[model samples]
Target: MLRLPKYLWFVRMKVNKIVELKTLYSFEAPVFDAHGTAGTSQSAELKNKLDLNSYLAPFPGETYLVKVSGESMINEGIYDGDILVVNKRDRPVDGKVVIASLNGEMAVKTYRDIHGVIYLFSANDKFLPIEIKPFWEFEIQGVVKHVIHAV
Candidate 1:
């Protein structure tokens, strides 16, 4: 599996702010052969036919396309409407931007540790840090690696 840094590549495309809703698009899957046979193929002809796969296939593994829904994360440069590249398999870490589900509600926030207490910091100070309670259910969906914005 080839893994790239979370935010390093998006800037090259002149995308600085958060990716908004209008830019969210599904990844295009690679097209397979329409008439290629899948059975025993030891012939030289079959080898040539199978080499026409597209290099533009959707990335392997499970991934989600999440649109930034709020502006509380602006300090991190994540604006409302940016598209986040969320790899669900990525582990969460301190000070890492993460998409999380809290008691069933989805949100994006920076994870911080203060005196053994985990605080979900929002950019807009008006939002409060979410204290992880004992009875609540929380899931770290993905560590946001990149943000894509519209030109």
Candidate 2:
């Protein structure tokens, strides 16, 4: 069974669907100094080479991808259809964006703690901050380390 936040995409796990965790595509691109033009500007023309694995694989095999949905996190630049890089093994501190299960349903929100009281805050004003409910089952699935949004 698959469950998620309101309006989130359903990741089919039992419908004979295939689910992939990571991709195999790789490309080595030249990095310019300070994201400046490398062809002309001398200040930004220094070329540096690096692999994508440096950022994506800080802890190899510990990261997983999760597709995001809903507008609750629009203010934080997280939108529907965005792919979230979640690190399940990493512990989230206060004010970190996280993937969590709320009462068996999944949700992505900013994790917050105020005077020992924990809360989940939505980036959008239309949604309200979710206070920790004593009777509800809430657990952090992972902390979002990066967001991949297609233009």
Candidate 3:
């Protein structure tokens, strides 16, 4: 996980929506300290401050974004138009959702370990679990930590 300080910021020139920011720039904002209902007005003791950057920031070069493109992971809440937060800096973990390039095709699947054998399982049962054979051009691109739905 990356942590960005409040003294500096970055700028993104978005044509439509917020894309992956690769550079840093100066940023300023008015941080609120009240924990109110999202759609309603409330008061607080001014003990908390909120910032979107705290949730997603300090994105390293290896921690990039990718847009999903299939229905294989629909059951897991990942859709075709969703943007995935992929962190290549971290090693792939068993039983975690990962972005992998299998035979030159990129796909998001659950990395499973069954008796020390690794396999990729699609959330949709229509697909079958793929064993990590010796002949495949398989590579773990990154581990998906966050997903942003387009809808």
Candidate 4:
């Protein structure tokens, strides 16, 4: 019942090479409190450089980014054009979002195992859960570690 995007693509990231921390750009920025008073502006200085590679992909060799395009997972805050940080080395836990291949097509969905039957669920209520059949070509490519979307 999931609606896949017309064109889905995966971009494999090569993060195996080690880069010197000093060579990376320093991106320190002020942090603001979202829950602060409406008129009050409170900012705090961050002491450390924001190394995206280290923060987002600790296990660089096994991590990759996949751009998603669909409304099926909107409720989970995964909208079209969102980038999913996936770790192939991570095990797919129950209720975790994962990148999966079904019948040679790629899709992202919450993984669940109920009574030993695997099911893929969409965050949006409009779509129904997909139950995996024994004969279907299915494989879990990686577990989604983080979802990056522009505000």
Candidate 5:
């Protein structure tokens, strides 16, 4: 018996509502070296104000945030409850993670083009690659630029 991938059984894009960030916050914080051993942070000094808006989304009008709700992309460092920064105006390139609509369903997957054939791949092995057919209604919504998650 040939067993299919788990994603084939039920593949649905779990995403929260599209949100527009109207405010940009800037704060001053000390930068620490992760490679160095942790002992005391009293020696570290703050240099500049870190602006999240400039670092994450340079163009706020073309960017939006979406919360993930699945473990399919865990291998790619995208986990459930992580917030994804999507750029609507950015083009989806090969090997890049993108937000796409297939057959009227939205999903976040890695985009790939092999020999003219488009395939959406999941970072986790449990889910199989999804081949995009000509008959399916497909559209690339945006390209994911950054993923925000708590430590």
Candidate 6:
């Protein structure tokens, strides 16, 4: 579900030689009715509020939501279960946090390139740097915009 702005996704997919591009989608709020419970007033309010989507819209140029699935970014305060906001439309630049595809595997990391050598960096020490040599296959997916941790 990790999403990037349209521009970012386009650039990455192009650079990575991805052959498919899926239609864009949005996130909808789920109903929390507490089914089987005695109907409560709170349920009505929850439904009403959830029905509104105006507040869920992102600012201009932002798109896509992906859930964090690992602890490799914990040192950067991005823990497992966090939701990542990706800007697919943004241009990838040095030092940007990006979602990368390596040999078809996906990862979220800080990207840095030095004289054509790409390095994937993780804030957590448990995860080591991933080097993208000229002979390796990889693609940048998108730039990370924000990380939302659910309390």
lDDT of every predicted structure (CA atoms): 0.59, 0.70, 0.65, 0.71, 0.80, 0.61
Off by over 4 Å in 6: 1-62
Which runs in model 2 stand beyond 4 Å of their true positions? 1-27, 34-46
Per-candidate count of clashing residue pairs (backbone under 3 Å): 8, 0, 2, 0, 0, 13
Candidate 2, residue 29: lDDT: 71
Clashes of 3: 2
Residue 52, model 4: Cα distance from true site in angstroms: 1.2
Once superposed on the true structure, which residue ranges of model 3 sit more than 4 Å away at CA?
A: 1-21, 26-47
**lDDT of each residue in 1-151, candidate 5, tens digit only:** 2332455535544676679755556644545434435785545444556666777888888989988888789989999899999999998899999998776567889999999999989888877788888877788999999999999
Per-residue lDDT over 15-73 for candidate 4, one digit per residue giving the tens place of the 0 to 100 score: 22222222244444444435556666665445555556667777777887888777888
Model 2: lDDT to the true structure: 0.70
TM-score of each: 0.58, 0.76, 0.69, 0.75, 0.83, 0.59
Q: Quick one: best TM-score, which candidate? A: 5
> Least accurate stretch of 10 residues (summed lDDT) in model 6?
10-19
lDDT of 1 by residue, 30-64 (tens): 43443545564543232222211122113324355
For model 5, the stretches where C-alpha displacement exceeds 4 angstroms are: 1-9, 24-35, 39-42
**Number of the candidate with higher TM-score, 4 or 5:** 5
lDDT by residue for model 2 over 42-82, one digit each (tens)? 56555877677557646646777777667788888988878
Ranked candidates, highest lDDT first: 5, 4, 2, 3, 6, 1
Number of colliding residue pairs in model 4: 0
Q: What 10-residue stretch in candidate 2 is worst by lDDT?
A: 10-19
* Deviation of model 1 at 63, angstroms: 2.7
What is the TM-score (0 to 1) of candidate 1? 0.58
Question: What lDDT tens digits, residue by residue, belong to model 3 across residues 1-151?
Answer: 2222222111110112224545464344455566756666676454544554435545556667777666777778887668877778778888888877665556688899888888888777666677777666778877888888856
**Per-residue CA lDDT of candidate 6, range 39-84, in tens?**
6544433453342223332443455666666667777777766766
The superposed Cα distance between candidate 1 and the true structure at residue 98, in angstroms, equals 0.4
